[model samples]
Target: METQAAETVERVQPHLAESLPVPVRVGKGVRRLALRVALVVEAAGGGVAAHIADLVRELRVRGGVEIHLVIPVGVRFDGVIIGDDVLAQCDTVHRLPMLRAVGRADTIAFARLFRCLHKISPDIVHSHSSKAGALARLCFGPWKQVYTPHAVYTLNPYLSRGQRRFYGLVEGVLGRFRSDRIIAVSVDEAEHLQRVLRIPAARIETIFNGVKKQPLLTAAEARSALGLPHDAVVIGFVGRLDFQKGVDRLVRVAQNILDRGLGNVIFAVMGPGDFTVASGVSADATPNNVRVLGALSQARTYFSAFDIFSLPSRYEGFPYVLLEAMAANVPIVSTRVSGAAELITAEHVGVVVPNEDDVTIFADTIAVLAQEPLTRERMSRNCERAIESFSATTMIERTVNLYNRLLKEHR
Candidate 1:
């Protein structure tokens, strides 16, 4: 069956190749209206970088904006590069020697940022992640600025009550000065901004993250490269190993699966984080059944090897990994936090357990899916259908429209 699946994917690869460079057309007038824009992001990695890179590429190719990217100096990560192909569309790339520091360093960063903003005189300044958003807004003065939190700092369960409240207060205060609009990656996140952070519902907009679906590689080829049997049931997790990712819970879930003696199952984690940082650390860590492939440059290769995908994040603004997994037509299992629940439906997609649920529930859900081949196939098909709503073109068009509207209103 696995061999046949591989053959099917291989046969379809040529059709996928023929569809290269998904066409995007922008009206000449709208292109002409494209304002001078600056995008700010903190240290790059993971989904945030991918999202920004995709938007930049699409904007440069389809829109008329004179785009400038302001990124931290000395930071390198997979998919961080905008590439010459995309860079050709941009007006400039500016590197700031701003360290990802707190206190005095942040003050210095703000100073530098203010100077840069003064020099660039951008029509719009869009910021991503916490540090960049805060600093960008602080330095904006009277300039139009927009922020996307990616997942607000206040959402982390690891923080103390005081810390959460302090962060929330800071965001509320900053909300008054720096933000013209708050872009929430999910509807759930938008609601939180309105209820908890007191951002006006009118000012908040939900824009779902978009992913480009790569041509499917054969499952046999994928498994063989990863050195797994053709018949193995593969469950894959992709994300950073930090506390927010809920990797500790994932381990417990994997252990439960092993304890239940499931046959020929393979578990793989693809991302970076120290195992020691995770709670519930044990001497008997990383059992034989589990493989930790830390931080692959291209997840599509590993994604192809999976029969199912899971993301047990404690909170998220919106996870691009989940979108990528869905695009790959893999069944999903994730916590009902952030946008994960909203993205997956019980009828069409995989299970969404409560955030605090024990690993047993997650493991048992995987067990059921593994045992039922027909159910897995149905879920996979549904994932393919769900992905239609989240193409890169949709994200670019909506974002560009927002940019134009905001620029017009300000003008």
Candidate 2:
């Protein structure tokens, strides 16, 4: 097995070597010419998948590039297809069966990718997420690589400090070989990458994620569907029930609200994650006036049920839920993490507080917002106004412009 693996590496080495030289720009209108680009990701899910889909759609509309999505093997995206509508706009969709394992999978994927890069000879390769970014950069040889971490790997609470440092070190080293630029979804994230990973500021660019405006459902309809009394003051949270989401904080805040005997106030947590006891919430445990809806796939439906949306995440790389909530004209109350602080203009859009702060403060803020209908309405209007800049069209244009500038400089 060792010998076979060695032989495979040897066979792929030449291909990697031959592909080291960058492709020459041939045409006078290279920018206008549809350049072949590969967008690689390890596993497609949630916000990352949404971003990829949006990027592909915009790239198609722009008409200057052909996108080929190269994803990991055995990664199934049921009911999601890059259909003829997308395919008709650009080039071919090539699916690579590259496994993701520690050593064996890495070697095999690198070998496969080395050969694929040689064959496709793409003008650019853009990678998303940690695994894909690392693997794509390692196997890229001399490809002009653009990496967007989506959310930096080091931000994960699951990693030990040493592990986080190691990952950052790896990213820094790889930055020299593979990355021409790193796109951070928020300035906070870019700063984190620079500080933790030692990636230079010059290599990092901050681009806030954008969403399309959604129509707000009537308060009556929203309240009725949520089983909330028409006159009840609704305070809502939307996101996964994961630790990083700080759902426990939200639950504790809910408990406090209920304990205070706040009249006509309902606390709802929309979205899903494991609500096991270990996660600080019981799947079966009941808290008075607390509604926990696990794993909401259709977020818009739940967004309609919220009078105010709160995100108590410990950290984030510009959450999509925030954008969606704003689009829905729901006032927000979020922790001062990532772009949330910058996005929430005090008394204009919503309130921003420190992470893991007192549950009373959180509960109090919600209670205050609940009591002041005019204030809530003002924040709601401000959120709607601020969302104009975050529209999908705006984000796509900015992203494409960046791509164009990068390609132009390199070409």
Candidate 3:
């Protein structure tokens, strides 16, 4: 029997690599059995989607791993339907009706998924996010199951204590009885699962999310792209609008930063939210000093224009946005959300605040970073030094190795 050699993968000319799919390697003479991976993800946008996209890219080129994407039927990423361009490289795509967040616990749907996976008989079923994590653990048949929680639902400050306890109970049951293995995106997240869910230390591993590096655009060019005034000091944020991201608090604190009258300091936001005029946090919440991009496919490309990249997330897993900032050598100010502390440990890299909801504190931190040019330059240098630690290539290689290990164990 013969198989394709992924090492001979035809490259997508450097310029077209981002939007277009690179051609997969397959030919008449092409002797390796691809490890079959059935990857399930309910949320098809934001950081987790970026992670999936990167994994898909590397797996297609690296060979020896046949990927089958099991994504939400009606979900979209970058404001477009998950189309054939996304499907262009995958071995298969399963668009099943599944909801993200809320831990979508519908047994009927789970049974249908189980039957589907049973037929495909993937070597391993790797699920992302809390909702998919809950469903994948139950969809177990012959496949080894691997779950990654972008953020643990039980530890989210936005949820009520009672709700947190319920989630904790559910996670405990899943870990004790159903889960095969778990992979946390950060060391903090891995530790939390071990401590809170009592998942054994050996059962979980931390693999940091990573970003692709590119020649950074000049500040002027990046500012032009985002419509920010080049002369102004800008603080940027990129994330989907949701409870976990704490966009509401972001707007308020950004307003406070302006109130302090720090001359020429502006807040630039890339990414959309549900905050319309109908929602209490409407367009008006964006003071004159703030610019909302709604959504931009290449928003992170504008990172160089920012004096500081701020992430006021109440809770998170490993965010691709933070890695993007690191790649751009942008200084950071983030809530000590799950994976943040690990990356923002050094003062030069930026500061991580303990209080998730303390908008004043978050605001104060950003203002200083925005105003201090020498400090920002030093942090930028530090980010350049640390970029290799968050390389997308590294993330993909480790993931492929894990898939192979699971296959060997299964045999």
For residues 275-393, write the lDDT of model 3, one tens digit per residue. Answer: 45312475655578878777776666678888888887877877778888988988888888887888888425889886556588888887887778999899999999998878889
lDDT string, candidate 2, 125-223, tens digits:
888888788878876454578888877877666688788778878888877556888889988899888887788888887888887655555778766
lDDT of 1 by residue, 1-411 (tens): 653232111112233333223223576533333467888777566888778778887776674576777777554333333444444445556655555555777886777777777776788899888888888988845467888899877777778988888889888777754688888898888888888888777677788899888776688887777677788899998888877888888888877888889857778877867755763565467656777776666666568889889888888888888888888988988888888877887336788877874777788788988888899899889988889898888988887778778878887
TM-score of each model, paired residue for residue: 0.87, 0.82, 0.87
Off by over 4 Å in 2: 1-33, 72-90, 94-104, 115-119, 156-158, 215-217, 220-229
| Steric overlap count per candidate | 0, 2, 2
What C-alpha lDDT do the candidate models reach, one value each? Answer: 0.75, 0.71, 0.75
Q: Is candidate 1 or candidate 2 better by lDDT?
A: 1
In model 1, state the lDDT of residue 347.
34
